[model samples]
Target chain A: MKIIACYSNKGGVGKTASSANLAHLMAQSGHKVLLCDLDPQGASSFYFRLKPAKKLSEDSFFTDQDKLLKAIKGSDYENLDVLPANMDFRDFDIFLSRLAKGHSALKKALKGVKKDYDIVLLDCPPTISMLSESVFSCANWVLVPVIPSTLSERTLEQLLDFFTQHKLEKSKILAFFSMVQVSKKLHLDTMQRLGEQHADLLLNTYIPFSSHIERMGVNRAPATDFAKATPAAQHYLDLWRELATRI
Target chain B: MPRLWHSQGEGDFTPLLSWLENKAVQRGLVLSQTEFLSGPLALIDNGDCQIAEQGKSLLRLSHKLLSISQRDIYPLHRKDQPPFDFPLPPRELCERIEQPPAWLLGLAPLRNLQILARGKGRYQQWRLTNRLHKTCGIIYLLDIELNGISAQHFCFCQTYRGFTKSEKLLTSWQRYIKDVFPGQTAGVSEIVALYRRHPLVVHHANTSMQKGRPDIASQTKRWLKPLLLAAFSNEQGIILDIDTEYLHQYRVNMRKARSLLSLCKGAFEENQQQHCANQLANWMQNTNVLRDLDVHLQDQVTYQQILPPHLHCQADKLRHNLQKERQIAQQRLSDQLQSTAYQTNKQILMQSIAQLNDGDKGQKPATQYGRKRLIRQLNKIFVLTGQLHDQSPDDELHRLRIALKKARYLAEFFQRPKTTKRLSVLASSLKQLTQDFGLFNDACVQQQALHGWLDSARAIKRPPSENIEALTLLLRYYQEQKRQTKYKISQHLRLLNDPNHQSALLAATQNLI
Candidate 1:
C-alpha cells in the first residue's frame, strides 16, 4: 500500500479537495482507498458526508489500535472509506511531540490499516510542525497543490529546502497547480515560470478554479460524486489518471 | 447471486418496506429506494447443479448478457464481442459448471428490488450484527418469478464489502428472523430446487446415487432405472451435439447398467434378464463405432504429444480424418436413436423391468444374497489375480481386470453403514488397480488401432510416410507405456493379495452375514 499526503504549508490551495477527489477516483477505478482526515478541519470527511468518528480523540487514535480501525467509516462510494477528523485532532502535534521518536508517530499509528487499503490518503493540515514531520515520514508521496501564485511558488521552494535540510527524499514532493485561473496574467506567468524552473517536480495537469468545487460544502460529497460533469471534477480525474501512471 | 427469503404472501412490498422504514426512523437512518427493473433470466448450471452447490451462485443469462455476480458479464447477443469461453474465472463458481450453455436449466421472469440505507451506521451495523450474512451491501430484493404462475421470492443481496464476522450477530439474526417471520423464510437455492423438481423445468434425469443399503432387487432396479433415464435424457443433447459429456455420460450409464446386469445375475426372471441383456448388448454394439471415434477425437492432444514436432501436420491430418469419421458416426447414432426399431426396443425394455418380480424364485433374502455374492466374487477375483504370471498375455490380464471390476461393482451394490469404512478402503485399492489396467489397455488399443489404420490406408492407397511415421511413434509410445506399467500392475496385485487386506475385506463383509 502507498500513503499519499495532500499537504501544503499554505491553506486554501485545494489540498483537502484534491485529496478527496483523488481518493474517490482511485476507489472508482477499483482500488480500495482510505482517506485519513489528518486535517483537524475535517474538510475531507465533510466532502464524504461522514461525521467525525464518535468519541475518537487524538491520543486514543494513535495509542488504541481498535479506535483508529473502528473510526474508519464507509463513504457513499463503494470502495472508498474515511477516518473522519475530530476536534480532538487539533492536539495531534502535541501528542506526537511527546512521543519517543516523535517524527515516526503517524507511521506507527497508520500501521494497523496498512494492509486493509490499497492507498491511504492523508488530508494533512496546513502547517510545518511535529505532525508535518510525522506526515512526511509516513507518506510515500507528498502531493502539494499550488494555487499558481507567487506566494504558493515561494512555499514550494521552502518545502524543497526543508526536505534538503532534513535529508528527506525531495523526489517525494509532487507539486501541481490547483485552483488555477488561466484568465489571470499573474497566475499564468507564475505557472509558466514554475514549469520551467521545476520541470520534474511539477505535474502537467492543473485543477481550474470553479464554483462547482465550492458547492462541495452544499453537496456534502466529493465533486466527483455530486458534480461529476463539472470542470474541477474532470481535472481531478485527469490528475488521478496521470498520478496512476507515475505511482 | 445472494441468498433469498420469501414472505408468506405476495402483491405487496408495503409491510416489509414499512418495517424497514420504521426501523430506520427508530435508529436515525436514511432509507433510499431504487426503481425496480424486471427481465427474463435463464439460470444455467450443470445437470447436477454443480455451480450453485459450490458458490451459491448461478449463471444468469438476462438482457442478452450472461454473467455470474461479481464475475464476467459477456453480451451473448452482441456479434462484435468474442464468444464466451468455458472454465470461467473467479474460481468460486464458474469452474464447477462444465459447458454452461449446454447446461441451461430453467428460464424465469425476474424482478429486481433494491432497498438502500435507512440509518447512519445501519449498513455496517446490520452486517456486524447478522452472523449468517456473507453478502456485502445488503439490498432487499423482491423477485416475482413465473413457476407455472407468478411466485414471489425476497432476496437479501450483498454488494461492496461483505458482512463483518461476528458470531453474536449470526445467532441473533437466526433467532430474530425465526421469531419475526417463522415458516415464511426460504433460501433462494431451496426455492430454485423446488422449481427444478418439475420435469419440464429440469430435463436432466436424477443421476445422483442413492444412499444406504436396500434390498438387492430394489437397489438394482433403483440404480438401473435412473441410469437408463439419464441416458434417455441425454439423447436429445447428444443429437444436438451440444457437448461431448452428454454422449459420454450416456455411454457411461449404459455401460454401468450393463455391468450391473452381468454381475448380479438371477436378480430377475431368467427369460427377462436374458432379453434385457440382449437388448443392452445390441444398443452398446450399435453405439460402439460412435463412442470409439469420440474417444479418438477427444484424445487428439495425447496423440499429438506422442509424435515428433515435424509430424504435427500429420497429426493434424489424422485428427481431421477422425473428426470426419466422428461426424458420420454421430449422424448414424442419431438416426438409430430416432429409429422406430430402437425406440420400440427401449420402450419394451423399460416396460418389461416393471413387470419383473423383485428377486428370482427360490432366491434367498436380498441382504443374504448380496453378502454371499460379494464373498463369492471376492474369492473369484483373488483366485484370478493369483493365477496371473509375469509373462501373462494381454488377454489374460484383461480377463483379470474384468473380474476385479465385477467384484468391485458387487461390493458397491451392497455398501451399508457398517461396511462403509472397509468398502472405502477396498474401493480406493480397486480404483488404483483399474487405473493401472486402464493404462495397460490403452497401450494395447493404440497399437491395434494404428495397425488397423495402416491396413485401411493400404486398401485405399499408399499412405503418406509422415502419417505412417506419426502412427509408428504413437505405437512405440504405447509400447513403452505397456512395458513400464508391467511392474506397477504386479505391485497393485500384491496389495490386493496381501493377507491383511484379505482379512480386512473378509471382516468388513463378514458382519453382513
Candidate 2:
C-alpha cells in the first residue's frame, strides 16, 4: 500500500480539492482508496457528504486500530471510503508532541489497514507542526499543490528547504501547479520559473482553474464524477494517471 | 443487502415500477430507468443435466461460457466452441463442475438440443437516487425466456452500501413483493426445469421398471425399448460425424441390447430372440471399423509418445493416413444410416420388439427369471475363474471378460430398490474385473491393428522407412503394455481366488436371488 499526503504548509492552494478529486479518480480507475480527512475543517469529508466520526478522537486515532477502522465510512462511490475528522483532530499536533517516537505513530496506526486499501490518501491541514512532521516521516510521497503565484512558490521553496534541513527524502516531494489560471502572465511566468528550477520534483500536468471544481461544494461529490467532461476533471484524471505511473 | 423474488404468473413489471415510483416520491428521491437486451444464448448440457444438477446454468454466447447461478453470472473465457464430447473443461471451469473426470469425459450434448434459442430475454434497471444523483438503491426486473416459453420475471433489489434510507425502502419493497408475488425465489434450478420441459430437448426414455413382481416379457420390453431408442437417437449424430462419442455410444447401446436378449433368453420366443440378436450384431459390425479408427485417432498422441523424437514426422504421416481411413469409414457408415434399407430394418426391428409375445418362461415372475439367470451367469464365471492361469491365452481372457460383462448387465437389469446395495457391489466388482481384462485386450488389438496397417501400407505403396520404424516402435510399446496389463490381471485373479472374496461374491449374488 502507498501513502500520499496531500499537504501544503501554505493554505488555500487547492490542497483539499486536489486530494478529493485525485482520490475519486484513483478509485474510478479500480484502486481501493481511503481518503483520510486529517484537517479539522473536514472539507474532504463534507465533500463526500459524510459526517464527522465522533467516536474517533485524536488520542484513539493512533493507538486504537479497531476504533480507527470502524470510523471509516463508505462513500457514495464504489471503492472509495472516507475517514472523517472531527474538531478533536485539531489537537493532533499537541497529542503527538507528548508521545515518544511520534514521528512513526501515524505509520503504525496505518499498518492495520495495509491489506484493506491500495492507497491511503491523507488530506492534510495546511500547517507546519508535529502532525506534519509525522506525515513527512511516514508518507511515500508528499504531494504539494501549489497555486501559480509568488507566495505559493515561496512556500514550496520553504517546504523543500525544510525537507533538506531535516534530512528527509527530498525526492518524496512531488509538487504540481493546481488552480492554474493560464490567462495571467504572472501565473505563467511563475510556473515556467518553477518548472526550470525544480525539474525533477514538479509534474508536467497541471489542474486548470474552472467553475466546475468550485461546484464540488454544491454537489457534495467529487468534481471528476459530476463534471466529468470539464477540463478541471480531465486534468485531475491526467494527473492521476501520471502519478499512478510514478507511484 | 440484496433480495431476489420471482413472480408466480406471467410477470408484469408495471405494478412493481409503480410501487417503486410511489416509494421514491414519499422518500423524496429521484427515480430513473434503464433497459437492456441480451443477444441469443444457447443452453448446453448432457443427457443427465450434470451442469444443472450442481445448480448452475451453462450457456454459450458467441465464444464465451457463462455460468449463471442464483446469485451471480461468471463468464468464463473460452476461445473455441467445445465439441459434443469435450475432453476436459478449461482450467477455470473445472472447479465449477463437481463431477469426476471420467463422467465429464463421457459428456455429450443432449440429442436435438445442440443449439437452443433462449436469447429473447430483457431486463430493466430501476435506480432510486437522491438530489446529488447518488444511486441509493437499484431494482432489476428480468424477463427470461427459454425457446419461446416465457419464464417468471425475477426482481432483484439491492441497497447501496452506507445508504440506510434505501434499506428502509428495500424492507418495505420486500414486504410488498412477498405479499404480491408470494412463494417464488427464482433460481437456476427453475430455469433448468424449464429446459427439461422444452419439446425440442430429447429426454432419456423412462427405462426403470416396477420394483416387485414384474412379468418377464413386459420388463424385458421396458428395458429393450429405451436401449433401442437411445441407439437410434445417435444415428443422426453419427451421420453428421459430430464426434467420436456418438459412434462409441451407438455401439455400446447396441451391445447392451444384444447382451440383454441373450441373457434373458427365455423371456422371448427363440426365433424372435435370434432375429433381434442378428440385427444388433449387423449394426455393430457396420460401425466396427469406424469405431476402431476413431480410437486410433484418439490415441495418436500416445502413439507419438511411444516413438523417438526423430519419428514424430513419420507419426504425423501415420496420423494423416489414419484420418483418411477414418473419413472413408465414417462416410460408409453415414451412407448406411441414411440408406432406405437401414430405415426399413430399424422399423422392422422396432415393430418386432413391440409385437413380441410371451414365451413359456415369459409368464413367470421377473425376479424369479432374473435370479435364475444371475445364478447361472455367476456359476459360469466361477467355472471360468477356476480355469484361469498366468498362461491363459488372450482368447480365454476375452471369454472370461465377456462372461463378467454379461453378469454385470444381468445384475443391472434385475436391480431393485430393496436389493441395490448387494447388487451394486457385485456389479462394481464385475466392472473392475472386466476393465482390467479390457485393458489387456485393447493393447493386444491395437498392436495387431498397427501391424496390419503397416503391412497394407507397404502393399499399396512402399512407405517411408521412418514410417515403418515408427509403426514398429508403437507396436512394441503396445506389446509391452499388453504384457503389463496381463500381469495386473493375473494379480487381480489371484485376489479373486481368495476364499473370503469368493464367498462374499457368492453371498451377494445369492441374497439377490
Highest DockQ scorer: 2
All candidates' TM-scores? 0.63, 0.63
The candidate 2 chain B region of ten consecutive residues with least summed lDDT is: B83-92
Q: TM for chain B in all models?
A: 0.72, 0.82
Query: In model 1, what are the clashing residue pairs, if there are any?
Result: B29-B118, B29-B119, B30-B118, B30-B119, B129-B169, B131-B169, B131-B170, B136-B158, B136-B159
Task: Summarize candidate 1's per-residue lDDT along A135-180 as a digit string, tens digits.
Answer: 9998999999998898888888889999999999988989999999
Q: Which stretches of candidate 1 lie over 4 Å from their true place?
A: A1-55, A60-70, A75-82, A96-247, B1-40, B54-80, B83-147, B151-215, B358-363, B485-487
Backbone clashes under 3 angstroms, per model: 9, 0
Model 2 DockQ class: incorrect
**Which residue pairs of candidate 2 clash?**
none
Q: Compose the digit string of candidate 1's lDDT tens values, residues B68-87.
A: 32222122233333433322
lDDT of 2 by residue, A1-247 (tens): 9999999999989999999999998887778899999999999988987778898999999999989987877776767888989999999999999999899999999998899899999999999989999999999999999998999999998998899889999999999999999999999999999999999999999999989999999998889989998989999999999999889
